[model samples]
Target: MKFNQYIFLLFSLFFLMSNSYAEINIKKCKANQGDYIIFDEYDSQIAEKIIDYKLHNQPEKRENSIIKIFANENSDDRNYWLASIQTDNKAEDYLFYQVDQNKFTEVDQQQFQILLPKIVECNQIKEVPIYSENFDAD
Candidate 1:
């Protein structure tokens, strides 16, 4: 009976470790005091550096934002990427990044204007109207 219990405990630990990949990492920004807005919900080791959803989390929660890699955008000769921070309709300022051996590092805007034409389309995400009314019928 004791041997069976030990085996079950070992299996549970192994299972927990295996499924913990890509857990979200949220750190309080000293600038913001303490807010759960900024977070990284991807495993740098496995998350695709190309074309991933990113939440704005500033004013309007989960504002439209996306990350793009150079290769993913069909630029074979260049190694570059940029993020579209939904400041407004068109992304004016970009949050560029560089991936080095599964480690993501933010870099300056490089080759963005040159690669601008390569983009197929940039869809605008409209904010859905929220109505505050009672849903319970007594």
Candidate 2:
């Protein structure tokens, strides 16, 4: 390659490398003990079947709330850097975006979905709900 072409290629590689992006775990969405990810945007219709999510007029609160940590990315397309579904949210979810992450009160249409639900507590005596899809016999 010519000297100028070589320089151009080197510059391009440097430019690409300079841009930082969030590290994502490609594992299929599941519960984690600590902070995990929520890569996919919300789909309300699909969520209704697999897990019991936010229901209108009835605030859902359990002993534990499911959460995921979204590292800030360098893309203009996505604004949410963090998303959460607390038991105290009163059936509504929240999205924390890049602009004012600590202050945002409402979830946007682009907010990440709760793809993985962390099972918290099972208090029923002697009987497990075998009807649950997530139930594991082992």
Candidate 3:
């Protein structure tokens, strides 16, 4: 009986360690950008960069806005870009994301509260068009 328990404990530890390592590797891959490595909680490394981006752009045009880029929770797809638009005062300005080759969707405050009861917030997200332009080839 003791031998069986030891085997089970070892197996569990091995599984847990391997699983965590895989997750860390994936996060590292996603966070890699040129010479800099973005760790799981390395916002400070890029915080100045985002702030600098806002500073360089014209305030009248950009409205002191910055887009905080984040990796998608669902990583099975590689063609999507997920981010959030932030204002200087507000924490949640809007969810700005791109899907495949289509439009850039924005989930603003008006649409965020329409989730169904007891449903998860992120899973309940639906894409909504933020901009569209029509052109004539003729």
Candidate 4:
């Protein structure tokens, strides 16, 4: 009986070690000028960085306010990253970056909206709409 218990414990430890290694080997997205947002399997925030850029001919520099990271998908060649970022006070934006091509572009708004629900679902965000009702006599 004691020998059987020992064998079970050893197998459990081996399985846990293998699973931990698998999670550790997941490929993470690499950012160039700005940093990419990373999240864990439980939808907990991991790492994030904000970037600042100035508009052409504008003196004021704006900070890229990233509220949340919706999703990140790697390209077939593993040289590009397609991600959706929710900006402060604005709709979610889709971004594509190619490492080899050295290209970065914002995808269309229509496509971004279409993917919003999927992103929210994957991120396990509980979205709730709030409505305010006002009753005033003038």
* Per-residue lDDT of candidate 4, residues 59-128 (tens digit): 2222333333333321122343334444445555555444455555455565445444443332222241
- Where does candidate 4 stray beyond 4 Å? 1-64, 67-77, 112-138
TM-score of candidate 1 to 2 decimals: 0.26
Specify the poorest-scoring 10-residue window by lDDT in model 1.
123-132
Writing each residue's lDDT as its tens digit, candidate 3 over 1-138 gives 999999999999998966552111112112222442223333333333333343454554345554444432233322233344555565654432233333344444543333111112222123321111121211
Model 2: per-residue Cα lDDT over 13-86, one tens digit each: 99886543333222222223334223343322223312233323232333344433342222222332334444
- Computed on alpha carbons, the lDDT of every model, listed in order, comes to 0.33, 0.34, 0.37, 0.36
Error of 4 at 61 (Å): 10
- Which candidate, 2 or 4, would have the higher TM-score against the true structure? 4
Write the candidate numbers in order of decreasing TM-score.
4, 3, 1, 2
TM-score head-to-head 1 vs 3, winner: 3
Residue 65 miss distance in model 4 (angstroms): 3.7
TM-score of each: 0.26, 0.24, 0.28, 0.29
List the candidate 2 regions with Cα displacement exceeding 4 Å: 1-63, 73-80, 88-92, 99-105, 108-138
